[model samples]
Target: MSEFDAIVVGAGPAGSSAAIRMANKKLNVLLVERADPPGSKNVSGGILWGNALAEIIPEWEKDIPLERLITHKGTTFLTKDSSISIDFRSTKFLENHSGYSVLRARMDNALANSARKAGAMVVTGVTVDRVAKEEGKVVGVEQDGEIITSDAVILAEGANPRVAIDSGLRKPIGDQDVAIGVKQIIRLPENTINERFNLKGSEGFAGEYVLSYLEGEAEAGGFLYTNKDTISIGAVISSSKLREDGQTHSYDIMESFVQHPHIAPLLEGGKLEEYSAHLVCEGGIDSVPRIYGDGYLIAGDAAGFSFSNGLMIQGMNYAITSGIAAADTVIEAKERGNFSSDSLASYERKLEDSYVLKDLKNFRNIDKVTWSRVTHRAIPKIAENLLYSMYHETGRPKKHLMQMILESSRDSGMSKSQLILESYRMMRRM
Candidate 1:
């Protein structure tokens, strides 16, 4: 019989952000989390980019406990025996409010604590079984047969959006629109990490790899990031594609990535400390669900708000921004004493006006390009072969770059015209 102004489900970035904003407005807000602690069940590759942190918590660099700030970025394409890498570094990224690398367990715990300090009531170790509805209007949430009434509910339940789907607010997401990401934290000496990635002081390096050597068999990509005294490494594969493959599991894909000649040396003496797996909403704008319902709103992965447009994987920023927008809508509803779908519809408008929806809408075709067999299998191989031919030195005669390109294209089984068209499409979409 407990009553509150609003109930926010899941204490990840989105939920905490919403709760913090609500509490700051003197609204009675409750943040319900299923984990024993705020981030106990959360796992991420852990990169916070853009100006999201500043918007949520100003002076965050000085006030928050973070692993490191990122100043080095690298992307590598791997063949069985060779690798090609591109790296970039900037002094601008070393400033006080720059991007950061963090462990979600620690970071989310801090975010939850901030919400509590802002006057939001946070309850952990409880799962919201369902949204309580009256005459098709969400009035509260049910947990362990107990009913807690609230004026509105915000669903930020991460990738597994059971509550949102169950509430009839969103259609069940298909596996084709999702990805399974498996990651591990491996302990390495701080000196070793610095030397391995060429980092100075607390600056960190992040590397993304596409395993072209695996050829037609590799249906996914890999990533490596340098943490304080540990390295984060992982692979993400289309869930439906992975299931279709049948013989490979996340562990196998991870092993293949680590054993790649270009990647093995950096992981030579590292000790594995943790392993985790989670689903990523990679559906782009096409997969985003309806934002508002009779008395509920969806944010974060629950609403398919993730964007993976090749160069970057962004979800946390989108989640945080959407959560703030949803909170603003709830605040407005409170003032008007109207929690109808019409009033909550403002959340959708805010999202559409912001970069969250704009970026996703702009790159709507990216998901299709990424999931294409040609991009996932053929393009990388062609690039690797082209690079190999261009770099290899022969005593007798050398082929021109154009000749190497033709040969590599022939080897990839695609005609020059097809390659040109696909490349053009990808460039436009990206």
Candidate 2:
């Protein structure tokens, strides 16, 4: 048996951040990972946004091995044959830095090394079977039929939180609350990426799309991110929708997205280098699990901390912020020599007070609206048809723009009254 002040399960951003913070405070910490190495099983669209990361490591840009800084952001709505895109490029995003694209494998390995250097013992290639409890209070963790006692345990076990669910601290995540994300890293020459996306040096672009190519009942969205020499393209679909429709597989939706007319040209000759899949917690603030209990704290995806508005998908920054907040609470508890639920409850309070919970709460309805069949089926088709009708050069005299708009609305199977009501409601909620 071994003992430490704190034992952190999972070596992704959340766990690494927690361990690094605790170790920096001079707490004896143990970071356990199931993979043969840190980040070996991690996959993401790989954008680290916001200043939440700088709180953990102030000099991350100077110390960490980051791939590219994102200076350009684009959002595209893709129809079968065309795409509507909005792009924003600014020198402000380049100066002082706002976000970066990273390879999780390399970044996480570096984070684990940083934690080790901060005096945390990192143990890889080990499976943590369960968390040990004493009188309904978590006291340690059990791994591979052995026990390692600690003052408290921090569970950062990504999307599928087996330990947290089994401990009865959280309900099992429902399929409706989850999304299946499939990603592929394609190898394109650096100059090719620069030419295709109009980038220079280590600056890169990221684009998110609502794809119209998945013509079936599958409601899905796609994303493309530029790295140093590779571009990550992927799609996320609601798992409940997929299962209910009896779809053969999710990859079919991804294939359709890649082959969409507006997307195919960018990937004309790129080689697929790696493929991976993972679950995303898309259920808004309503789905957050119990954050603190007995002698344990939960952070990151394990606690359902992610926000996916129609325009942005943010998870990494939330994970980093929540992880740091949880560590701060634990460090306070250690100071008082108390690991009770009362002592650790501040973690939940702080998280709720932070922008992580505030933004999720504010945009709670956006997730429902974004995934609603109305937006998925009607919005794109209506817009595309309206544009086609207005832009087509017919021999007949052009009708007034208002008359054309009404005709297009009717042609798209939407009444003016219905459009007005829906648009008003969407605007109010969003």
TM-score of each: 0.95, 0.96
* Candidate 2 lDDT over residue span 1-430, tens digit each: 3379899999888999999999999999999999877988999898888777677688887777777899999977787776877888999987768788888888888888889999999999987888988889898988766788999899999989998888788998997668899999999999999999999999989888887545566778888999999998999887877887786488988888888878888988999989999998888787898799888999999998988643467888888888899899999999999989999999978987999889888887887677765566567777777788788898889788787766666644466677788778788778
Could you tell me which 10 consecutive residues in candidate 1 have the lowest summed lDDT? 210-219
Model 1 residue runs over 4 Å out of place are 96-98, 215-218, 309-311
Supply the global lDDT for candidate 1.
0.83
> C-alpha displacement of 298 in model 2, angstroms?
0.3
Q: What is the lDDT of residue 72 in candidate 1?
A: 90
Q: What digit string (tens of lDDT, one per residue) describes model 1 on residues 46-118?
A: 7876677566688777665677788998877666776778888988776654567878888889889989999
Q: After superposition, how far is residue 284 of candidate 2 from its true place, in Å?
A: 1.4
lDDT of candidates 1 onward, in order: 0.83, 0.85
Residues forming the 10-long window of minimal summed lDDT in candidate 2: 405-414
